[model samples]
Target: MNYTLHQLQVFLKISQTLSITRAAEELNLTQPAVSIQLRNLQDQFDIPLTEVIGRRLYLTDFGREIALAAEKVLNEAYAINHRTLAHKGLLYGKLKVSVVSTGKYVMPYFLTEFMRQHEGIELVMDVTNRQKVVDSVANNEVDFALVSILPPHLNVARLDLMPNKLYLVGAGPTGQLREEAEPELLKKLPLIYREAGSGTRQMMESFLAAHQIVVKKRLELTSNEAVKQALLAGLGYSVMPLIGLKSELLNNDLQILPMAGLPLQTVWMLIWPKDKQFSPVAQAYLAYIRDHKDAIVQQHFGWYERFL
Candidate 1:
């Protein structure tokens, strides 16, 4: 294409502000320079981009189409520049990670030291349910994903990060059931379930099935915080990752039911598409996890020993 990125940027700015003077001011260029760039871009396309009418400027149909293309082009160019910097041994890049809801509780601690060390790295973390995390991984939309249970369908490069233990917790009746009859806890208590697509919910289902326990569902919650709050309010008993309940557990606001086959243990993992190569930022973070995961987990979850 004859149109340069500089000219396209100038045109896009003009399209956004609808004023040559304003665009020039925002771009730190003279009005004449902005106009010249816009003119050059329009010339390359052989189309009139903007029209002045009644003291206002508006983009023509062709201009609007080109503006969309310009936006995509600029975004791709920005990504390329960041990639180039990363290849040059500069940590100036963005790292996008999709994490399951419960993983949110642990990922920040893992990221803190890494981020502190790499000042130029921009971290974008997407906290969602397990299914969406998997979708992002499948589509290669994110650099990595943090999840407890990996889906069996997708081929991924997996790294075990730490242990995630699921606890049966509640406020009132649920605890009484644990004390009253250990085996009947699952069958008798009103159970609050994480939504169907969640990894926690999947684990809960598997546990229930393996033990031939059928419980009454009291509620379905979408998030870890929501489930925790519900359990605290005596809404019902729910299975949750222990990492998310540190504060409440420490404060004794919620009780962990000491039932048989309790504290279901699973590994927290970092995964990326098998077909894609890891970026420097992703590689660095993965290496950090490999080197320091045990220390970090021990530091944050030292309280775990008291329960044992």
Candidate 2:
């Protein structure tokens, strides 16, 4: 039997609520109509859908199977509705965005501010490592990603929404270490770098490579905080983005070492497909990021002078 969208919807309602009376109330249909729809669907599949157990309705094995399929059909119908709505400039749908863990410190402020301005839009954020963020955007799993930097040819489009300066942090020995802690300072100490494929790590490597400052013996770790802690513990010094430890530097827990030609300044980028640009709401967020990024840093870092 050919199933209609209404029948699929009613069946899903019953499947979710597990009560024919409640499903009818939700669909604004009589109980008899709801029962008839479920029967028609069960008959089409030639299977038993429900059984009476202890005076409560229970799904038979076949009924459970059909309910799952029916839910998928209902979901697809909703997706089609959303796609049409999107085409009409509605911008009122789930926008999945992924970001590297480090960007969690900065990107959210811009995104939250944008959401407050566009109340109709719904946002879903998936925060993970930098590699995962890039992969999600590359495979179309996420519509956009905010990361420190992208690969040389990552098969996507990118926009540097705002400038992001790298900071050399340490609470270790001063003078020899601090004086040589600039972007070109990697050669002076055993540099503790983030794991490979980290947007931050990769950017730092490329910058150092460009300046011909190969680290003497590079040690790799995973998180930004770990690197900072190691530096403060006097394990080794590391280069990190200013966004990650802006507060620590300001609070005197860490010191930003002064170095010559070190920490080649890069920026946080809003990355997406070269083929599929961005939705109108996404464009708006990008604009707001550029306009208000400096203010965001000033608010979070406390002492605005450090950022400059």
Candidate 3:
């Protein structure tokens, strides 16, 4: 705990390189100074951080723990500095967003357009399922989240953009999945499904649950693309976000199933923690989305409607 930032840096460098002389050279500090800093840290902790097993220094468990923590501290400090520069009209920062997997299918172009305008801002995107995206926001792993199906959680705040309509898509002998089929026949095909914790999957289940309809044959996949692939190969069929398989639907690679119980709906949202002081980068994305709210809804919903 008595380690200064410089001391932690030295400790990390030495732990990584396992050579005191090399780490000191890398830090442009004399070997003696680096040794002194390390000794001070060890004395403060009352433990040996590095051990001389033979000729090399190896990080003990405590040393590794401190090194990992040091990296977080340094990265967050850099993020704070970037945020400060951005808020002063510098408009330079890394915008990190966690998104639902289906959203990754369509949101990149919008993000790219923004990146072009604010060339100084970098984009970091993590595409995952809805639960993971929410967890990222609540745990501060990402600055914000773009979610298509907002889960029921009290810790996060969501901005309701629009309701997302689900589609039951497949590749089975189809002009359209429902072209010649009636409702009872439509449910007979292999039902490819999103994995548990998928907001879309939950919505689909809930919709069917209302009618006491449960898909007897269910094949679960992690991502929308994986579901599409499985459907195309005739492994199974799935209910999916329309964004994921638009080209497939148009090109007849897949077909939308026409069933009375299909095409369930869930709300699309942008969510973040309710912290008082979110980073400038996070705040900027929120502000940008708020300002361009209409344009975003029009774009995605318009695309969703096109296939209908």
User: All candidates: CA RMSD in angstroms?
Assistant: 8.7, 10.5, 9.1
Report, for every candidate in turn, its global Cα lDDT versus the true structure.
0.84, 0.75, 0.74
User: How do all models score by TM-score?
Assistant: 0.71, 0.63, 0.66
Local accuracy of candidate 2 as per-residue lDDT tens digits, 1-308:
69888888887888788899999987879999999998887677766788778878888887788789888887787788778767876656667789887888767776776677665576878888977887787688877888876645677777665666776667744767645544555677778889887877877777777778767755677888788778777777677887777667767877777776655577778788888766676676667777887677566545534465
lDDT of 1 by residue, 90-184 (tens): 78777899999888887898899999988778788988878889999999999999988878889998888778888788874342554634545
Q: For model 2, name the residue pairs that clash.
A: 182-259, 182-262, 183-262, 183-263, 184-262
The model with the greatest lDDT is 1
Model 3 CA RMSD to the hidden true structure, in angstroms: 9.1
lDDT per residue as tens, model 3, 32-133: 998898897788787677888878688889888878987888777668877786677777777888888888765675566577777667788888777778
- Badly placed stretches (over 4 Å) of model 3 are 1-89, 172-183, 297-301
* Deviating ranges (above 4 Å) for candidate 2: 1-91, 154-157, 178-188, 207-218, 277-305
The segments of candidate 1 whose C-alpha lies over 4 angstroms from its true place after superposition are 1-89, 172-180
Choose 1 or 3, whichever is better by lDDT: 1
Q: Per lDDT, what order, best first?
A: 1, 2, 3
